[model samples]
Target: MSQLRVLRVVERAHGILSSRDADAPDVAQVNEAHRSLRPEEVSKAVSACDRRDFLSMSACSLATALLAACNSRGPDEAEKVLRFAERQNEVVERWLLRHTAMNHARGRIAGSAFPMYFISKTLPVWDTATRGPWMLDVSGLVDRPMRFTLEDLVRLPARRQRVDHFCVEGWNAVAEWWGVRVSELARVVGVRAEAKYVDFRSFDSNFHESWDLESATHPQTIVAYAKDGKFLPPPYGAPARLHSPIKLGYKNTKYLTNVVFMAKRNGGYWSDQGYEWYGGT
Candidate 1:
C-alpha cells in the first residue's frame, strides 16, 4: 500500500510534466530527467525511509525542474508565481477535503510504511512513562510566558485538519493532524504587538525553526500533538510538533519544546544550510 502511494505520486508527477508547456526549457529538462530513470530506478529513488534518504531520492527527481524554474526570469514572473501557487493550493485543499480520514500515513517514500525521516544525526528518546509531566514552554516577547504540560495541551481547544505536507525535496503526503492553533497559544502567552517572528525550539538536537508572526499565528498553524488519531509517533515528532499547512515539511519542527516570539529571525536548522528562510508552500 505504501509503495502504491509512491507510485501514484510518480504518476502524478508525470501528469504534471505533461500539463507543463513543452516548449519551456525547464519543462523539457525536467521531462528528460524523469524519462532518463528506469521504472526500477524510480522505485528505488522513492523508497526513502528517513530524512537523509528522502532528500537524496527526491532531489534526484526534482533537480531538473528546480534548475529550470530558477533559470526563468521575467517581468510578469511574480504574477506567474502567484497564479501557480494559487493553483497548487486549490488542488491541495480539494484533495484534503476528499481524503480526511485520520488514519494511514503513506507517501512517495516507498520502503517505509511510515514515511517520516529523522534528518538529525542522533535521535532524542524521551521517557514515555513520564509523559504527563512533559512541558511545552511558550515564552519570549510576550506579556505572560506560560508552560503547558501534555495534559494541559490536550485540554486546550483542539482542532484537526487533514492537510498536504510538502517536503522541500519535492515529495508530499496528506495526514490528519490534531492540535491547538498557534494563535490560541499566542493569545495565552499574550504575544506582544511588536513581535515579528515565532521561533520554535525543539528538544531533538536543540533543533529550531522560525516563522513570520503572521504565519505562525495563521489558523492552519498548530502545535500538533497527534497525527491520524493517535499520539504522534516519535519519528513524526511525537509528544508535539509545529504543523503549518502553508509551510514545507522542514518548517514543521518535531519534538517541539518551546516557542519564543521575537523581533528578529532565529534561523532554522535547515535554513542555516541554504534552504529558504521562508519555506512557504
Candidate 2:
C-alpha cells in the first residue's frame, strides 16, 4: 500500500543476471540499491532487461499506481500521481507542446478530481480556497535558499518542450508542460562547490527522489503549474513539481513538499525496497 517498491541490481554484463542482493553490487557497480524502485533499472539496463519482461513487471507496478488513485482512503493520492506524470510530461514537451498538441491540462477536467482505478493517472490538482506563498526553497549545498511565488514564477521567462516520458515501470507517454526554467532556478539557488546531488520530496507522507545536479538543470527540467492553459490539477502537483529529462517515474513526484540539495546522494523511498535510487532510466 505504500506505493513504494525496491529493486536490486544484482549483476550486469556477459549474460543473464538475477541475484537480489543490492548491497553486494555484482553488476557494474549498481546505483541506489533498494526495493522502492522496483521495475526500474539503469537506462542501458532497461533496454537489456527485455521489453516482454518489463511490460509484465510494469503491469504490476502500473496496478499499484492505479490502485493508489482509485481507492477512496487514498484521497487525492490519485491526483498526486497523475499530476506528477503530467508535470513530468509537461517538462518533456515544454519546448514542443503547442496548441496542436491535444489533451493538455486545463482542457479536460477543470477543477475536477481524477477517476479512481486509473492506470497511473496524469491528472492535475488544486485548492482554490487556500493559497500558499509558492516557494521553491533550493537549499542544502546551494548558495541561497530562494523562494518564489506562483506569479513570481510565471512572470519569469518560461520554457516549452516535447519529449518521451519513459517510466521506470516500462511504458512511455508524450505531453507538453509549461513553467519556469529549472536552469534559471539553479542559477538563482546557486549550487555550492560541494553540491553534487539533489533530493525532492512530496506531500504524500515522505515520498522522495534523489538525482545528480547534472540532471537538475536540464533544459527540459522545470517546476510546472499550467498544463494546456489552466492551473495544474492537484494530483499533478498543482502548486509545483520538479521535472527533468533524467530519472524515471519514481523520480518525478507529485505534491512536492521539498527540494533539498546535498553533497552526497541520499537513498529514495523505493530505493530501500531494491530499486535503484539513482533512477537514471
Cα RMSD of all models vs. native, in order, equals: 23.7, 24.4
What is the C-alpha lDDT profile of model 1 across 1-281, one tens digit per residue? Answer: 35564464466556653556474435565566557656765656466465666788899879765665564553345666766776676455435432122223354322235467666686665665865456899999999999998889999999887777778889777778899999999998899988999999987886798987867877888999988878887888878989876778888888898999999998899978756677775
Model 2 backbone overlap count: 47
> RMSD to the native, candidate 1?
23.7
**What are the runs in model 1 whose C-alpha is more than 4 Å off?**
1-114, 128-132
Expressed as tens digits, the lDDT of each residue in 17-134 for candidate 2 is 4444354434444443433234544343435566668889999999987876676556564656755775575455444533233222223232233221111344433344574555
lDDT of 1 at 33: 57
Q: What is the lDDT of residue 216 in candidate 1?
A: 80
Q: Give the Cα-based TM-score of candidate 1 against the true structure.
A: 0.59
Count of steric clashes across candidates, in order: 1, 47
Most accurate candidate by lDDT:
1
